[model samples]
Target: MDDATARTQLESMLAELDRSITVLRGDPDAPGDRSLADAGADLTDADRARAMLDVAARQRTAVLDALKRLDSGDYGRCVDCGKPVPEGRLAARPEASRCVQCQSVRERRR
Candidate 1:
């Protein structure tokens, strides 16, 4: 994807993430049904929300980092190995900071 497309996608994702945070903040205390099973379900919902929030946070960071790279004229290079990341991979994940090999190695380490 081109820089314009990447920026647009990142902005959209950021907005969605902000909306999600607003929803979560609006429900600071989760309401639960009377039954134990129902309460458990509420906890499950909270867990899912938390997980989504985490993902959003990471995505936001990734986008911001990508933006910085764009500004520096280093947008398409892998952060880990300083290699040019494939356009196909960038199309798949615009915020990727590592080439496939480097990313795989990083993931394996994690």
Candidate 2:
């Protein structure tokens, strides 16, 4: 995808992620505001929220990194192999930093 399109998508993703993270975190300044984890524990709701928050935070970081790459004119290029990541992959995950091959290899190592 072109940088403009990618930027728009990435920015939208960033905004949504930010909202998710904020809601999960809760408003600390409010009256006795507790986090999602603190608000509920029955049926492991707190644990579930914590897990979701962690994932959202990590995804947010990825989006930020992708934005940096876009600014640097390095977006859509695999970080490991410097190959152009497929358009399909970018469309699916705009924050992706590796081609499928490289990503597979890295996952195997992990």
- Best-performing candidate as measured by TM-score: 2
Clashing pairs for predicted structure model 2, backbone only: none
In model 2, the runs with Cα more than 4 Å from the true position are 27-40
TM-score of 1: 0.81
The clash count of every prediction, one per candidate, is 0, 0
Quality of model 2 by C-alpha lDDT: 0.91
Q: Candidate 2 on 1-110: residue-level lDDT in tens?
A: 99999999999999999899888876545676567776665337556778999999999999999999999999999999999999999999999999999999999999
**Lowest summed lDDT over 10 consecutive residues: which window, candidate 2?**
38-47
TM-scores across all candidates?
0.81, 0.84
Name the lDDT value of residue 52 in candidate 1: 78
How big is the RMSD of model 2? 3.9
Pairs with steric clashes in candidate 1: none
